[model samples]
Target: MHFDLVDLRLFIQIAESPSMTQGARKAFMSPAAASARIKNLEESLASRLLYRDSRGVELTPAGQLFLQHARVIMRQVDYMKNEFTEYGAEASGHIRIFANTTAATEFLPEILAGFLAQRPGVTVDLQERLSRDIVRGVMDGSTDIGIIAGPIKADGLQVIHFSTDQLIVITPLEHPLAQRKKIKLTETLSYPHIGLHEGTTLLRFLNEQVALSGQTLNMRIQVYSFEAMCRMVEAGVGLAIIPESSARRHQQTMGLKIIELDEPWRVRERSILVRDLEALPAVIRALISIFLTHDSARERRS
Candidate 1:
């Protein structure tokens, strides 16, 4: 029962992408060919791999099991290629990262710039995902490292402190609650709000708060960037719950009010999650070491 690594790679792509067809397209193959390759793989293994529906493809239990092995095989192949090219290439390998919207938007750019500057030969492939999904990607071996906002249950994961962030309400200076120093999130629910695009980590967290308090949020506008959301709030469109770090940056420029949230969950702590610290690739370890050093320096300065 032999299968092509290309097919395995295609299957991994399909498992990660929105659909089987998109995965095929990514592999530079047609949809029919992708399906046939997956079918052959399943037939060879004598197990169903994916569950397809209107939404998209999801890994079945068997598929999840298969992914673990496939990732190991792929990593081994990558390692061999890099080893062979070590003399020709100074330092080069791909690092896959899964980070939530907060880490992706807030502090990653600065940290990543520093990392890449020092390791010019390394390339990074980063994808933004919800915190929980980020954990899943790390646990499933889809990504080498994951930066998640706030605390989450990532069973079988090695967790370490990455950073601290928080969600705060941003309002026009003249808004009703602008005078208040701090307020419960539920108190602001009645007012029309400006929210980030759906599916973002901050937006999802806010929605969960709304759901828990049994209050509906009047989200007037959904914008892409934190700065855009602040601009909308400044225009008297509505208020928004945004990261304090971002909001603080726009405070003077946008003339917006940053109101601390009364809820304990408002202050978020970011953590790095990995499957096995010892097993991390050398490049990944180097990257993590730099981040840790930076965080320590900030701590000392603060």
Candidate 2:
């Protein structure tokens, strides 16, 4: 029937206080204005809502029924206001994020833990995929944010350089190459390698490096996951190139030896991807800030 929110608010105040003067005071309006609002609301509903006599104003049968609906609408409006208010402060709502396997398993855990500690009301749903898939997810509206190793070419996504990760060459502790201080590209290819599948960014980067050094990587196994690569290296199956963070994450249990790749292929930048900078919700922005500032500080300390 198109009753105004102002009239609904006045009706609620009058219903609660049962006194038009008190309702007017609570609403910061004159008694005449409050009565007129109540009158308009009753007219909109085509019913007589209140009857005033010796004992404060009393609701008619229709007024009592409509009051129930009015209370529900008021509560819903209040909840909406609170939700938006908390959203602005990064204190509420859900965030959908996509990350590569390395970031999902190795890096994002601690960062997400810290973010949740600060903003418990905000929930994050993270999905792990290949770096290329992560970029596609961000572009296709499947995810609110993404983290991946760069050379990202997605035109629709906004990329931010968040942190740098070094790829380390790993081998079984007993492997003869484990003792090396720095492994050259040529030396690396001399050993059979356990590597990621063909389409992954890591594999692409390694292939580029191998081509640049005028050698072909003697890839022995093509696995889909880094954890699998680590297990294979631990079993002395073959050596693999993986991020230093992933190496450290499994260091103790895997008992694998890790060596820094020599000059040419040392570090890779981990970039944050967003669909639109302006469209990012406050909680996601706060999380990005947390990752940037906290990871930078942790990197400096190390």
Candidate 3:
């Protein structure tokens, strides 16, 4: 009935990664050893932790509960280590972030690069997720920070507003939709649309909208990035809906036309969600400040 930090950490890693083997690699252990350790841990706790399948693994109800506490325990351990080494070492810690598609793809890459450049000891694990899922991740302590957009409620969490951007439609210059300055979601659903990949947040949101209108989106192709989506649109594959920031950037070089979305939900505020910002580690707070600073610079320019 006894387990140590290694067992806890291994379980957490397996729970986060795509496969036990991948998690083992991150933990600097062999897959066989990792499997054995997990088995022993389950036996000691008298409960199953993961559901295994060909696709990789999923957390069982018990496993999800375990992960919640495991993350909190690991964070506290990190805090203790940092306090002990305050005099001898520079600020150092790992920050786990969950962000919606717009923030993750449009904004974070350059911003994170600058943050990392200045803080050599800090590392980040970033994932793109739906806004609701990001809220859940923050509530469960599984994520250190979440950058979410849209009308998702963060009732109990501390929210910090950052950037405001809208979803804009892009089409080939010769496309019929390009002749208009603005278009509605309903107008675009009938046309062949270039979508982001299957599991992306924006695609899911678009699907929900199409469902409400009693029609289906004609998703001709799915690409992995904003640039790819724009490229497909430029090639006359289909229309695309992307963040204004990304659309503007790609439109400058591609033969794509930007059309404003005539929907209220099109404009969304991107914000930071955290359980308690001040309770976070110093390294994490510094990164948050960087986001705020970047937003301020954008504000001044606008």
- After superposition, candidate 3 runs with Cα above 4 Å error: 1-67, 83-90
Shift in Å, residue 218, candidate 2:
4.3
lDDT of 1 by residue, 1-302 (tens): 88978977898889879998899989999999899999899999999999988888999999989988788678767755754555333256678899988778767789989778876678899899988889888887778899987878998899988678778888899999999999998899889999878889888888887899888889888988888998999999999998887898888688898899989898888788888877766777777887788878876886
Q: What is the lDDT of residue 18 in candidate 2?
A: 59
> Using TM-score as the measure, what is the rank order of every candidate, best first?
1, 3, 2
Candidates sorted on lDDT, descending: 3, 1, 2
User: lDDT of each model, Cα atoms only?
Assistant: 0.84, 0.80, 0.87
Local distance difference test, candidate 1? 0.84
On TM-score, the leading prediction is 1
**1-302 per-residue lDDT for model 3 (tens digits):** 88889988888898889999999998999999999999998899898999988899899999988888788787768765764554323357778999988788888999999878876777789999887899999988888999988876777899998889889999999998889998889999879999999888899988998899899999899988999999999999999999998988888899999999999889988889998887787777888888999989987986
Number of colliding residue pairs in each model = 0, 0, 0
Superior by lDDT: candidate 1 or candidate 3: 3
Please list the residue runs of candidate 2 whose C-alpha ends up more than 4 Å from where it truly belongs after superposition: 1-88, 117-120, 154-157, 196-200, 207-228, 252-254, 263-265
The Cα error of candidate 2 at residue 162, in Å, is: 1.5
Best by lDDT: 3
Which scores greater on TM-score, model 2 or model 3?
Answer: 3
Mind giving the per-residue lDDT tens digits that candidate 2 earns over 253-286? 8879999888544777888998667656566777
Determine which window of 10 residues in candidate 3 has minimal summed lDDT. 82-91
